[model samples]
Every structure is written in C-alpha cells, then in structure tokens.
Target: MPVTPQPLGRRERNKQEKLDRITAAATELFAQYGVDDVTTQQIADKADIGTGTLFLYARNKGELLLLVQNAHYAEALERGRAEAETIPNVLGAVMAIVRPIVECNRVQVDNGRFYLREMVFGDPAEPHHGQALSIVARTEEAIAAALGRHGPIATGDAATTARIISAVMFVTMAASVNASLTTAAILQDIEAQVSLLARR
Candidate 1:
C-alpha cells in the first residue's frame, strides 16, 4: 500500500503561507515596477506582513530577488518542459525549454540581470541559493529529456550536452537583458550555436 503524505503542522503551514504571500507580492511588484525600484517595505506592505516578519523571510532585497524569482523560474521550467516535448529537433527542443524564462527576463531585464547575477555569484549560505540550484538542475533535466525524445545527439551524455545548451541559452538571455541586444538577435545567435551542437 502507498503511504499517505503527512499534513503540515500549524507553524509550518503559517510559515509556508507567509512565504507564498511574499513570493506572490514580490513577483508582481518586481514584474510591474522592476526589482531595482521596489523596496522591502513595499513588499512587506503588499504581503500584509510587518517589515520585521518580512526580514525573517528575506534579510534584504537581494535575497528577496531570489525568493521571488525562484517560484517564477520553477513555473517557467515546467512550461518549457511541456513545450520542448512538441519540438522535433534538439535545438528547437532546448530553445523550447529556455523560451519562457527568456521571455520573463525580457519583461523586466534589469531584475533579470540582477537576479541572474545573484544566482551565479550569491553565497551558497543563502536560502534561495539552494532553490536556484534545484530549479536549474530541473531545467537541465528537462533539456536532456527533450533531447532524448528528439533522438540521439552527437556522442556524450545528454546531460552534459544539455548543460552546454543551457549555458548558451542563458548567455543569450543575459545579453538580451544586460547588453541591450534584441531577443530575436539573441535567439538567432542561439540558433546558430544549436545547429553546431545538435548537428541537423
């Protein structure tokens, strides 16, 4: 027989509720006004929590960026996975996996720039650092799965090739946000890179 999942206790439930509220509020405010322009007090007010309570969740704006984007990135990964399944080639498949996230970045490029930077360089001791790692791991898994479905890529494990594809997509996305390149131009560059890897 399958084991039943345990219900969350009151304290755990309350903590999760606060976390959810803060994530929702931050995602909205950051998407609308951009991360650099938003304040912790504004996020607290939006979440209906005291500044002190908000501090318990995120020590500062940088942590808040990771907290907010982690959920969005997870959602993007899921969407990318589904889209990747429908694509015929590994290049298209990988692009499918990255498109949602790249689009999210396109909306508020400044936040995307800072958020990506933080994810890349933030101290591992931070709570959201783990979340970012988990999310990225899932994305890489999605790319590998997509490549598997599309058929064999050139020699080497799909996971390793997927890592290269992910890096390319991320670089393209970062350039789109920070370097003022058009998404189309960045995607074209990504396509050029993918052709060599996927070798269609």
Candidate 2:
C-alpha cells in the first residue's frame, strides 16, 4: 500500500517558519559583519523574533554561526566529492575533493576560522556542532575512497591517510599564520603537502 506522510500541524509550521527566518537572518548578518561582530540581539531583531525565542533556536552566536555555516560546508563537500569523481591521479583527485572546501572556508576568513574553532571546541551535545563533525567525517570518507581507488593502498592505510590529510587541510586553514594568505597560496601549500602525503 502507498502511504502518505502526515503534514505538520499549526505549531510545527510556525516553529519551522521561525527557524527559517532565524537562519536567513543569521546568514545575512554573519556574512556582512562576520561572526565575531554580530550580536544575538541583532540577529533576533532581524529575524523578527524575541531574544528568548532566538535562544530557543540557538543558544549563542557561535551556535548561530554553526547553524549558518553547516549548510554551506555540506554543500561544498558535495561539490568537491562530485569533482573528485572525474579526476584519475590520486593527488589530483584528493585535491579536487579539497579545493571547494578551502574555497568555502575562505569565503569570510574570520568566520571560517571561528567556525573551525567551534567545531573543535563547541559542545558535542549541540546539534549544529554534531552536524559540523559529521561533515568532516564524510569528507574523510570521500578522501579515503579516492585514495583506495587510485592505488594499491590498504583500506586501513587509506582511512588513516585520509585522516591525516583532513587534519593537514583543517590545521592549515585554521592556523593563525595562514590567516593573511590568499586562497590560492593556501591551496598551493595544501597541494604540496598532499602531494608528499599521497606519494606511494
């Protein structure tokens, strides 16, 4: 038998509407002023919700930033994964899976850096933080698949190498020293390191 899902009730619809508004407001404000400069009150005002209501959705500005960046990071990962499928060489394939992520993180450098910090240091109990970690896990899985596909690497080695590559990419992006470097320069550095790592 074909089954139709039940529809959301009034309360659920209202909650979803508020969440959408909150996400949109946070995305715009965070993009304009960066995460550190934007206040929760400002987000609430823009979302047309009370501060308490905003808190109900996201407890603080960091959480709000997670809510905004998680979507973008997920999209970037998918784009990179798709691009990686077309490249044959191991290094080229790995970098294809990395380039969009680096580009996404550099969109607003400060926000990107803070988002990385939050992913590392934020409460795991938080839903958004968990989503961020899931994206990282998915990224590593994609890289490991690429490594395994292009060479005679063992499954365990591929997974371990992928973890190292992910760490390298994230640390390079989040490092204070690389904050001033252009995206191309950072990508070059990552490619160099990845080349050394990908060598069989």
Candidate 3:
C-alpha cells in the first residue's frame, strides 16, 4: 500500500517552521552584513540549517531581498488603499495614496531606503524590474482616475496629470531613499511643492 500523506495542519506547521527559520536568519544576516554581502551558506549556517535547506526557502539572496521588499510594499499599499476609500475628496485620495509610502519611511526608514536603492537604481540584472514598473504604472493610473472623476487638473489631461504625479512620487521616493528626513517632513515638503504647482 502507498504511504499516507500528512494532515493539512501538520503540513502547514512544517512550512511555517521552515519559513520562520529562514526569515529570522535573513533578518539578522541582512541587518549585519547587508543583502549583497550575505551568502547562502552563511544564511543557512545562521539559521542552523544546511545550504540545501536554505534553497527550499529562497532561490538566492536576491530573491530574498525581493520578498522582503514586496512584503513591505504590499502592506503599505493595502493600508493606503483602505484609507483612500474612506476619503471623499480627490486631493485627499491622492494624499491617501502617498500617506502609506510616507508612513513606511516613518516606521521603517532603513528598510524603505534599502528597497528604494535596490529597486530604483539597482543593477539591470535585478529580477523585480517589471513588477516595480507595473506598480508605478498602476499607481499613476489610479491617480489619473481620481483626477478625472473629481475635477480637471490644470493640464486638462488626466493621463498627463497621472504621469506628473508618478514623476513626483518617484522623485520624492528617490530623495528620501538616502536622506535623513522624516516621513512627515517629506510630506510637508511635498505639500508645499504641490501647492505651488496648483497655483501656477
């Protein structure tokens, strides 16, 4: 007779156990030595697992970095989207979209900084380029829809406004990537810049 499979609960517990070990090791290693400097063998040793075991969790360090970055962005985006749904005004909605990204910098500035560096300016060999570009385009489209729904932007073209909004967000994200500024301070600066643009 064939061997019986494990229960779902047992399988899930096993998976979580493995993931916990991997994530914990990754955090410690990445914090101490940075992502690029940390090796698969080192991560496995840190986690008290074999190199083969580490491969079960992550294909490579680059993949691990993508996981860390995507997890944060997913959380921030969910928070921002939920908050935006609560506001009625278009500008408020726009601000809602920005607020989560800003809040990320407030709570995990170093994490945000690292992600921005790898994402916006990392090597062409990086794997998440398409995903990052998709995110940028999606965010701009969301803003454009909001603008078109509420009132005309000064440009009168929602698509153009969306592109402009995307550019502004990109620039702000780049600036804060390596700077010492707080999220609230960055948001204040953005508000001033946007106000000036509106007045023109």
RMSD of each: 2.5, 0.7, 5.8
Q: Write the per-residue lDDT of candidate 2 for residues 1-200, one digit (tens) a residue.
A: 99999999999999999999999999999999999899999999999999999999989988999999999999999999998999999999999999999999999999999999999999999999999999999999999999999999999999999999999999999999999999999999999999998996
Residues 1-200 of candidate 3 have per-residue lDDT tens digits of 99999767987898788777888888777767777677888888877888887777667776666555565566776677677677777777777777776676445555555666656665545445445555666666666666665665654577777677667765775674436876777787666655444333
- Candidate 1 residue lDDT tens string, 118-185: 88888778889889878878988887787777776543577888888888877777664435876676
| Candidate 1 stretches greater than 4 Å from native | 1-7, 176-178
Clashing pairs in 3: none
Cα-based TM-score, every candidate:
0.85, 0.98, 0.68
Query: Which scores greater on lDDT, model 2 or model 3?
Result: 2
lDDT of each: 0.82, 0.96, 0.67
Q: Counting only residues 3 or more apart in sequence or on different chains, how many pairs clash (N, Cα, C under 3 Å) in candidate 2? A: 0
In terms of lDDT, the poorest run of 10 residues in model 1 is 174-183
For candidate 3, the lDDT comes to: 0.67
Off by over 4 Å in 3: 1-21, 27-42, 51-63, 123-129, 153-156, 176-178, 196-200
